[model samples]
Target: MTELLKPELYAVVGTMSAPLHPSLKGGRCMACGFVFFPPQRYGCEVCGRSGDCLQSIALSGSGTLIASATVHMHSPGARPTKHGVKPLEAPFTIGTIKLDDGPTIRTIIVDANEPSLKPGQRVISKLVEVGSGACSILDLRFAPAL
Candidate 1:
């Protein structure tokens, strides 16, 4: 009937009207020229101006390990559960990666069972899935070069 069609049309429109996820696109400062991943707030902290810049910037995943340490305790953002991801194993290595773009991000180091790791080691970025279904979230992880 007409009533039934109306509801269906609204549903379709609602889905299309949903705001895109921030992680789906890279972000650029609208004030200065600083580009950041996962987007950034307007009004550049560097130039202190707004609406001067506007554009989407992609992040370069290439980077190097600046420091690393092993973690034995589960933290709020570290653990993954049935609904999400849990710590794969105890004493996992977490490292600070310095991107070529001058941004430093902290991430878990995958397959760090080697004898040891050192600073200045080449590393690559990878996406980690946490949770399941609609609640899933993507996390950043790094791995040492072979």
Candidate 2:
């Protein structure tokens, strides 16, 4: 029998399921309605509410492409572990996407070439598998929305 693989990264992105489509998990201030990605752990930056006032909230992965650029160089050590992840190839396209809700985030653009991307293009979130063996990691990426 095949063993189930545990997620290398959890609580960051949703599973690849029907209703639980891939989305970023962020933090919301229960004291207020402010939301933040990389979920604030200390306290609400807006209202200064700490303790249990912070709650986990799922963020919409769909958004608009705001900007794009090709990275010609990067440090390997700065990259995620090379286990199941693909080797870093320069000139990859990463872009800023403005989530439909309110926040803007940067993500690697998949399923489209850098030259093809344009400002204001719609995109949807997708979870991709990287690395290999037991070190496999799941990463969030965006693609042109159909």
Candidate 3:
């Protein structure tokens, strides 16, 4: 079995065994009906209610891309590392997406058969392998739905 990079942020079910391919772990304010990502336990931003007022929910994986930018590096072998994370490779794209549910989030974009992204482009959540060893370490990513 593969390991999830962030089990608290999202969930992915096997294609043949489950219905939801991927879903974001989000939170909703039971009092005010406000929805937000990252499933925070703190007080809701829209209302002052906390504790029992916050409820965890599974959000749909579809969203619309608001904007995107690709980062490029100039020098080779000059990558910087923080903590234990290896420096990100150049030409990786980051996108600001507004989920269909209501909140906006920023995440890495991977080209999965879709063309260049533009504002208002449709995107969907997908799992990507990030580890290099025998055991697979899977992380979530946003990809164009075309």
Task: Specify the highest-TM-score model's number.
Answer: 3
Q: Count the backbone clashes (under 3 Å) in each candidate.
A: 6, 5, 0
Error of 2 at 46 (Å): 1.6
Off by over 4 Å in 3: 14-20, 74-87, 112-115
Q: Report the C-alpha lDDT of model 1 over 10-123, residue by residue, as the tens digit.
A: 111111222121112345665556655445546565665555375554445556889998877655575443443444666688888776555677767886753477899887
Measured on C-alpha atoms, candidate 1 has an lDDT of 0.55
* lDDT by residue for model 3 (48-111), tens: 7899999988877788999888777636765432222234677788889998887898988997
List the candidates ranked by TM-score, beginning with the highest: 3, 2, 1
- Tens-digit lDDT track of model 2 for 1-146: 11212232123445343134466667788888778776657988889998789987667778889999988897666664444566657767899988765668887888888899999999888766665566546667788987
Ranking by lDDT: 3, 2, 1
Candidate 1 at residue 96, lDDT? 85
Which scores better on TM-score, 1 or 3? 3
Collision count of model 1: 6
Residue 139 accuracy (lDDT) in model 1? 53
Cα error, residue 24 of model 1, in Å, equals 9.3
